[model samples]
Target: MQQSEALCPKFEFAFSILSRKWTGLIIQTLLPGPKRFREIADMIPNMSDRMLSERLKELEGEGIVMRTVYPDIPVRIEYALTEKGKSLESVMREVQKWAQQWVDC
Candidate 1:
């Protein structure tokens, strides 16, 4: 057992991203399809506009979400998960299953 591992046994880089507040739920919400800003905000009940904007920016910085702005009518904007983000789907699903199984006990 190494000194570093002993001191921080659960210091995982991937889990760091997964552990962020609302990050898991946000990723789950986007699994169905891409969405506009307002659409996402509306769907996530009680999610403040400011917090959503900030989290989206953070996810974008982390390469999990891609934001696109269109130049056509109404200047549409949309957000979608990147390949990196899609990779989390299965991980989240397994976690969901485990949680439900254990939490019910």
Candidate 2:
């Protein structure tokens, strides 16, 4: 029998980011467009503000998410996906399609 090859490091890194709790949901939620802190928190139920904040920061650091701050009277802030993150749209769509067919809620 042929030997199985080891997992690719890039795939491992991507999986590591996606496997984290709340990461996928956060990315999915931002797929439509940019959203404020409260908007994201509201869209994803059961995710604490602290956890949301933490996950956003991690995604931002990974260059997957872009955080914008508008210097207004109240200082509006929004989170959106960068080009690198937006490239995952097809991947996300595929996962959603697969889940719809195979995943039982």
Candidate 3:
């Protein structure tokens, strides 16, 4: 089946991913650089490891994120944005700008 079709019959694309509580945050985190699984987990301290892993898997399956495995002593895996994921950067930036107007750091 097609992508939209896969998400259909129940949860649509928006509700399936973007509408999730921490999904947007995870996308934002990947904007900076490729991050390891632990890095994403650390960045999103409130989100459980299982939840993060699930989200990553979901995103990967959606063709938004790329999972890279390094050949080394142990093995290091990292997650980075695919072209589709990077396309959301503009949307994220706009959201950031809007939030900054109210939320102060």
Positional deviation of residue 92's Cα in model 1 after best superposition, in angstroms: 1.2
Per residue, candidate 3 scores C-alpha lDDT tens digits across 1-105 of: 778655454446555668877899999999998999999999989999999999999999999899999997699899999999999899899889999998888
lDDT of prediction 3 = 0.89
Task: Estimate, for each residue in 1-105, the C-alpha lDDT of model 2 and write its tens digit.
Answer: 334576678998999999999999999999999999999999998999999999999999999999999999899999999998898888899999999999999
Runs of candidate 1 exceeding 4 Å displacement: 2-11
What is the model-wide C-alpha lDDT for candidate 2?
0.94
CA shift of 93, model 1, Å? 0.5
For every candidate, C-alpha RMSD to the true structure in Å: 2.8, 1.6, 6.2
What TM-score, computed on C-alpha atoms, does each candidate reach? 0.82, 0.93, 0.82
How would you order the candidates by lDDT, starting with the best? 2, 3, 1
Model 3, which residues run further than 4 Å from truth?
1-16, 103-105
lDDT of each: 0.87, 0.94, 0.89
- Per-residue lDDT of 68 in model 2: 98
Better of 1 and 3 by TM-score: 1
Winner by TM-score: 2
